[model samples]
Target: MTTNDPAGDPAAARGNAARARSFGAVAAAYDAGRPTFPSEALTWILGPGRGLQVLDLGAGTGKLAAVAAELGHHVIAVDPSPEMLEVCRRRQGIDTMVGAAESIPLAHGSVDAVIVGQAFHWFDHARALPEIARVLRPNGVLGLLWNDADTVVPWVRRISQVMQGDCQTVTHSGGGDRFEPMPILEGSNLFWMIEQARFRHWQDLDRKGLRQLALSHSAVAILKETRREQVLEQIDQIYEHTARPPEPLRMPYLTDCFRAHPSEFANYRRTLDSPVAPHL
Candidate 1:
């Protein structure tokens, strides 16, 4: 028998295993094309801080680390990609290391909170959760987040359909596989069934930038050069469709936030299932 980690679906995780092992060329373009989290989500996760010792897991480009620092927290960024870490190192106020969700190198019980940006879907959460729980001070928060394009807009949705058409698994999460059915955390613990938030941003690109973004994807770069070119051409065609006559193309995003607290509540379950019974 085989099992997939934290947030991946069973069959999907099997399909994704080989591709998940490396993120070489996708590093830079991921930083470029991806959107950052909203300030509100950060505050909701970090709170109006006295000060926080935070971990940015799968901290690609130190983007969230940069944000956490701005919020007056001590931040450490971790990722497995050296090429990705090189870009992260250039960013100010971030302490970076080579690591992944499955095996974190930091000491046990070291952080006040952990924030996982768009990379949660890639983790083995069973391994990661215990490791994360170990490193976090008791009652510390864990935030899992993503910044997906706000594809509710007709053009934006159409663009996403084109960009992701070949990809079988469109929805994502690291929390998806691990945390559900434990308890559906509510009120503060859950967001509505559908949620959206917007930010205005611009990116300038040459063909190289375009290629960088294309290469950043796990799916696109995994293919051969001819196949890669075919996909790239398809992407360009889609972008051309979106551009009205003459307009520089830019994508829009709605940062989605999912936050959870490790409950002191789990102990109650163990107690009920305990072999020794106490009179009620």
Candidate 2:
């Protein structure tokens, strides 16, 4: 959820929004390139529960939702992009809706859990947090998931550098040594505690898949035709140098999962504040 730009920069904010929205144009590429969440991570996120109603907020292509559904939970997948939701709709056991985090479509206390996969960074926490707190049932869990390239590996470090234009490197979030509480969650007094877990996984990629991976990036996807091609070429060059013949390249990822529980007081307040439907 960390960005290289300063928080107060208006241009950076605009650029980030553009990047966030850029995925719809390359939704297919994103589905092909993005790795699925490890089952262990989802299991941990859901705790020891079963058959809970799960809402995959900001659910791009239903990656996390599909896994949650497979694990026996009914999943509601919500995203703002029609193109992305189209891909998500193809998945079984998932109900798709077009919505944003700032304004969730579900009723208050409607869902047992809310999971956001690789999309929490895009949210306006001030607004989204309250909406999230509203939809969550009492004792409901809020989970945030991210898959970061394990740059601790030597060659993967080079790939991250290439992806970020070689000027700066991507920083790991959630599972790093320093444990800083998220200000939005902590200050809101809606959540009682924050707990995190890390899982390791690998994605196998061929040359075509590698190209798709580069094309899927918002920063690269939004580039003009020629500049985008240049970035792809650089990425291909790295692939050629690092990848071995007859063996698919194994890209390592650290799936960082975080879960927070709603405070009893917050749940009680939301219940009291909720509007009732009129009796006919």
> Which candidate number would show the highest TM-score if scored against the true structure?
2
lDDT of each: 0.63, 0.81
Q: Tell me the RMSD of model 1 versus the true structure.
A: 7.6
Which run of 10 residues does model 1 get worst, by summed lDDT?
173-182
Write out the backbone clash pairs for model 1.
Answer: 6-125, 7-177, 26-216
Best candidate per lDDT, number?
Answer: 2
Q: Residue-wise lDDT of candidate 2 within 1-280, one digit each (tens)?
A: 4433323356655666777899999999989988899989999988766788899999989999999999999899999999999999999999999999999998888888899998877776667888888888887899988888888888777766666663242232322322223665677788878887889999999988988987877767777898888888888998899999789999999887789988877787787989522211
Off by over 4 Å in 1: 1-11, 170-211, 244-250, 265-280
Instruction: Provide the RMSD of all predictions against the true structure, rounded to 1 decimal.
Output: 7.6, 3.5
Q: Mind giving the per-residue lDDT tens digits that candidate 1 earns over 196-222?
A: 233433344544455566566666657
lDDT accuracy of residue 203 in candidate 2: 96
